[model samples]
Target: MYLLLVFRAMRNFIVVGHKATTTPSFSLEDIPGTSGRLDILCRAVTAAFVISHGIRKDVCVYLVLLGGEIPKTIRLVGETLRHLNPDERTTAALLKKALAVPATPEWAMSTSGIFVRTGGLAEVLTDLKDAKLIYLREDGADIRGLDAPGKDSSLSGEAAFILGDHTGMTPEEEALIEQAGARVVSLGATSLHADHCIVLINWFLDTNVFMSG
Candidate 1:
C-alpha cells in the first residue's frame, strides 16, 4: 500500500543537466562547481517548485551532475516543501546534502515527498517512463510548442520534461533523450537559462490548468 501511494502521487517533472560538477568534493563551497554548477541546479529546482500561482505542486526535479567526483545524478520529488527555506538557501543546502549521498538504483524517499537517486541523464529518463510516466525533451525540433493551444491534449498521462544547464545539453545527452523515445518539444525561439525555462514551462502548463485540475 505504501508503494501504491507513492506511485499515485507522482507528478510531471522537469529534468535539467548540470554538466559542471567537475568539483573534487561534495562540499557547498565547491558548488557552482568548477564543472557542475549547483547555482543553476538550485535555481532550476526552486523555479520548478514555485510555479505561477505560488502554490506548490507535486513535481519531480532531476539534476544530472557531470562534473562531480563521480558524475552523479540527483532526483528530488516535490515533497521538500517543509524544509525548503525562502531564497535559494534551503534548496542549496539540500543539494549539498544530496551530493554527499551515495547512489541508489531505485527511487528512495529522502524525506516526506522528496526522493533522490544517483544516476545520469539517460538513466533517470528511462526509469521514470518505465514507471509509466510520459517524458518529453524540450527542443527546437519540428516538435510542438508547449504554449500552443491544444498542445496540452497531446500529452496524456503523467508527464515529465527535460532541459539543459548553463552549457546546455551535450550532444551525447541529446542523443540519449532522443533514443529514449521522448517527444521533442519547444518553447518559442528565444533561448533562456534552464531555471527560466522551467518557470515558463510550469506557467504555461498551469495556465492550461494541467496540475490544478
Candidate 2:
C-alpha cells in the first residue's frame, strides 16, 4: 500500500490469473475456502490494507485467482478501510476474515477494506478507461535517463500502472496489455523487482534525484 500512497495518482492494481483455474470470469463470492488460492491471496490483501489510511480515500487492489479449484477475482476497495491496525498481525487476521466471506458481489467488511468482485485486468482497465484514466504498462523501454526529454511529463496526472508479480507477466498477460494499448515505460535497464520499481517511481516523481546524471 505504501506504493499506492507514494504514487497517489495510482489508485488501482490488478493481478492477472494465468495459471489459476475456474471459469473465465468468476466472482469471489461463495467459493469454498479449499477452492481458492489463499497464500498469495492473503499477501495481496495485506499489501492492500498496509497502504490504506484508516479513513478511506484512494487506492484499490484486485486479485484474479484463476488457477485454483474455483476461479475467483477479489477486490479491496480503499474507501471502506476502517479500524484496521497497520501491523502484520492485524492484517493477517483481517485476511483470514476476508477468506471466509461468502462469495457474493456484496462488499465483505474487513478491518481494512471491502473485498467484492473478481475482475480480469482487461475488464478493470475498461472501467478505468470509461473513467478517462491514463494507463501505462510498467515495462518495455527504460525511462531512467530520459527524464529531461519529456518522458517524465507523460506520467503527469492521475493514472494507473500495470505491474506483475515476482514471476513476471506471462505471454497471455502481455497480450491483454497490448489490447489495452497501455503505454510501456521503464525505470532502468537492470531488472528490478516490482516492489523496487514502485519505490523508484515514487522517488523520481517526488524529487529530482533521478534527473541527476
Candidate 3:
C-alpha cells in the first residue's frame, strides 16, 4: 500500500548492472574501469533527479548490482535525499558510501536518503508490482506515442523505467524483464547512453508529450 502510493505520486528508474560490485570495495576514482561500469549507473542516478535549482522529491533511482552471488540494491529517494551533486563522480561517491555500510536483509540507511538492501531484479519487480513498468530499448514502440509508457490518468506520469548497463542485459535478464510485463519502448532509431535516455524520458513527461494527440 505504501509503495503503491509512492509510485502513484512519483517516477521510478531502475538500472540493472551485471557487473557492478555488491560490496563497498569499488574504487570511486575509477568507477567504470574498476567498479564494473558503475559509473554508468552513477550518471543515470544523477540524471534522474537533478533539476536546475533543486531535486525532484518525487523521483527515485534503483541500482541493481548483480556482480556478486547475492544481489545488492540501492534505493536513492529524492524526497529526503540530501548532499547530492549534479556530477556523476559525486553520485559515485555517494554510492561508495552506501556500499561501505552494512546492508542487512532489510533496507539500511547509508546516508540521508540512500537505502541499501540485499535484492536484485526480481526484488525490484516485486516492489513495483502495482506500478506501470516501462522498459527502455533500442527497438520497440516509439515512447512518445504510447500510453502504456505512462503519463495517463492512472499515475499522471510513467512509473518504473528499466534500463541496462553498457554491456546491456543478458538473455536471462531480458527474460526476467519480459516476465515482469515491462513495456518495451524506444527513444529513437539510434541507441543512446542510459543517462541520456533517462533525461529524454523525463523531458517527455515534463513537457507533456500528449500534445501530439
Best lDDT among the predictions, by candidate number:
3
Each prediction's RMSD to truth: 5.6, 7.7, 5.1
**Which candidate do you rate higher for lDDT, 1 or 2?**
1
Supply every candidate's count of residue pairs whose N, Cα or C atoms clash at under 3 angstroms.
9, 12, 0
TM-score of each model, paired residue for residue? 0.74, 0.62, 0.88
What ordering of candidates by TM-score runs from best to worst?
3, 1, 2
lDDT against the true structure, each candidate: 0.59, 0.51, 0.83
Pairs of colliding residues, candidate 1: 20-35, 20-36, 21-35, 21-36, 21-67, 21-68, 22-35, 22-67, 32-38
On a 0 to 100 scale, what is the lDDT of residue 90 in model 2?
A: 51
lDDT, candidate 2, residue 165? 56
If the candidates were sorted by their lDDT against the true structure, best first, what order would they fall in?
A: 3, 1, 2
Residues 1-213, candidate 1, lDDT per residue (tens digit)?
A: 355332323455555555545233545555554435677777887787764445365677777777654556667666554476445656776766655455566655554555556567767776776432333334355333332434543443466777776666767877877787666666656767777777866665555543333
Off by over 4 Å in 3: 1-8, 147-158, 209-213
